[model samples]
Target: MGVQLKSSSLSPTVDHILDSRRHNSCLTLDAVPKFACRVKYLNLLLLSAMPGCCFCEGMALSRLLLLVLVAELAAASSDVGFVFDGFTGEANLSLNGYAEVTSEGLLKLTNFTPEMTGHAFYPSPINFKNATDGRPISFSTTFVFAIVPVYPNMSGHGIAFALAPSKELPGSMPSQYLGLFSKSDNGQASNHVVAVELDTVKSVDFADINANHVGIDVNDLKSVNASPVAYFDSREGVLKSLQLISGEPMQVWVDYDGGEMKLGVMVAPLNKPKPQVPLVSFTINLSSIVLDEMYVGMSAATGAATGCHYILGWSFGLNRDAPPLDLSKLPKLPRQGSPTKRSTEVLAIELTLAAIILLLISTAAVILIIRRRKKFAEMHEDWELEYGPHRFSYKDLYRATKGFDEQNLLGVGGFGRVYKGVLPTSKMEIAVKKISHDSKQGMREFISEIVSMGRLRHRNLVQLLGYCRRQGELLLVYDYITNGSLDR
Candidate 1:
């Protein structure tokens, strides 16, 4: 029976050739070569109709023709590969998890949703080994992709271009595994998997080199060869770094030479020519890891943080260089809605300014407290140390007497004004005498007599509690006698 090819963009002439069942006879293997000749003739007609069709690039038409030719050869020979500039007419891709083909023909592997996994693969398996020796065959692939993080410069996990024995990796995990392997299956030789990882997070369990790196993984996430995300500048003769989460489109090229057992990976910004130097190069024998038939695809995963991984174009060829992607024909990336790095810098500046203002306010409050304490400072002398038990702080006295306001005055005698007061700590009522400044001449003798009298204790006489002296004031504390002080 003839293999049916379903494509919406194919001309009626090509469609008739692909769907031979409509002719009431099954096409044999011999007809495939003859069908290829018809396809080449249809390509000339398709090229002439390109101006009338939606596709503006003539190169895109050639790429489509090449993909159909390769798909035919895949049936008869081991050289199997295909190309897709966009997913508009693609119907044979196998999608799982969050993977979807967008209305704009973009193959979105993962979205902003957290803790998700997605996979997109060619529907059929490809021959990866030689029948004679069972040795691995050479292959090349190139893809254009972009990562749009939910936050600038931050994304959870990353994406990987993988080749595995099965398209659906049962029991696989998301996040650090890139949806290819689970914790139990990782690093097992039976997996028979090879992948190129574009990691954005540093996973210690996997011994990742850094947060941003490209690694070549074989049956395990622990890469045998890895490098920081960077590209060589041929003109500058230096290696320049690239940010994978910059929300810009980038191209990656992977090539494996079965003869030399060498694998090379290169990366660069979209529309830029491939770098002369490869980002990661290593010697690896794939014959033991690659199965006879395997599926080729891309897988991605998200952790606590997430970014949308999009594939704009892809091409693969066995025993030949994969066709270059037509950047002009790829879908445009969605404009980033998340805040940029500039906004984060602005927030940092605002926080710093707020901290400075808070510090200034705290310093001013401390200075005000110090000034107020000095206003109520008491005079101290060595002799007063012996009367420490009988002395009261000026601050306490000032607060107790309410600054000696006229309302608290009990009487004005010849010595000074007697004010009704209370002890702050003891909450005991007392009487305070503020001696006139002119009484300073005999203040020492008077204070001595008062101290001596304080030693006297009688129920009928008011008791002396304590005393406080300021630079220009002498204050005496006496026990309070209620009911108008017996004279009022």
Candidate 2:
């Protein structure tokens, strides 16, 4: 597939070059150098034809051609500028010291290891200056990083985004020097280093503004310009302070304009949009500090009080805005040890307590159910089995009479209250009499008399079915007469 751009009569030659690169895939990496040369000569020819029209037209077309060339170069192994969401399986980085690509795909600079210095650089050097005039060109870079200290308030040295002539910086010291320079060569011009530092610990010799600040350094650890870590909130239109050792990820943007010769540094919480105002801005010419060809990389160091420094994602552009990082895809930061561990233990303990409470509630419910079942239990005696005319249980008789309810009452006599009911199982109608007895006489004697009386059945008289004895009440069951009550 190829892209097509509308051709204009303003410049036919420029349109031809654009068409050839888009429709024809022949302008590969090998022909890039030759193609670029041809564009330069064509620019002169266009300007000679029409002075004013060709000047503006040629310049605009040149920018378009430059974007195409840069896009092609970024796809190659040796990129002028690149973007890395993570470092996993990446072969373009040269790492040293404690630097490594973690299993979580983080570019770890300084780990929990103390007194260590680490450096990681792009495999190839980038052309920072113009070929015609040796002046530093405009560049922009942005990265998401984090500084996690062992203690809450304490931290080691810091980290820096550095551009050096060589990939490796020999004889650099850790701690306050920031792995960029030693005490002896602190301000030497021959060092030729331009760096933007995210310093966590202040050094008196370097005249650091505070323990946490972003600084711009050239050929020395002493910052030429520095400001506390903060971002300008466009919505609220105010500045907010940030903590470096809070173990949270933050994003930083460093942009330099060679035309105005201004350098600006800005920082905000991770996933936030870039701030409109820069935290630290200074007027400085990097031409003297940065060489023609320089390696862009990061450097970090740890003193006695160490911490883990990580780079989650990075993007850089030579003369355009760096591509924005996809925050959702970046690797997650490692969990803090002490706080995370304690929280986990507390969660487990809470779950165990809840389970125990649930089990206790379940056991108590079962015991209550068994106790309630026994409360309504029917009383049975072995002696009652001897004399019986189908002795109905207390529970069955109680149910037949609907618990001797007043509503089912047939009549009330001096001996007891008689109630009319139907047997649940046999569907036979009957009348039950409930009489209160407080006698200490033998229960078998009373049951025997009642059983014999129940056997005396006649056609004209009501038949006695059975008798039941409970707590302090004696119940008698008889056939229900549907005609009329004797008293009525």
What TM-score against the true fold does each predicted structure earn? 0.64, 0.56
Which ranges of candidate 1 are over 4 A from the true structure?
A: 1-139, 144-156, 165-168, 174-176, 200-212, 241-249, 256-262, 282-295, 301-340, 343-347, 381-383, 398-427, 433-446, 449-461, 470-475, 486-488
The pairs that clash in candidate 1 are none
lDDT of 2 by residue, 1-488 (tens): 00111111122354545554444323333433322343453443334322234222455665565556555543331224677877686536888888888888899999877788899887666666654455667888898898887767788989999998877788888998878888888899999898999999988988898999999998988898999999888788888899887778899999989788899999999868898778888888888777756888899999988988889888887666776777887888876324334445777899999999999999999999887566446446787667554577766766777877888989988888889888889999988888888773786777787778778977766777787776777878887888655233
Question: Which candidate's TM-score is highest?
Answer: 1
Question: lDDT by residue for model 1 over 282-391, one digit each (tens)?
Answer: 88888888876788999999989898998988888877778767778888776432334544677789999999999999999998888887878777877677778888
Model 2 misplacement above 4 A: 1-79, 336-488
Alpha-carbon lDDT of model 1: 0.78
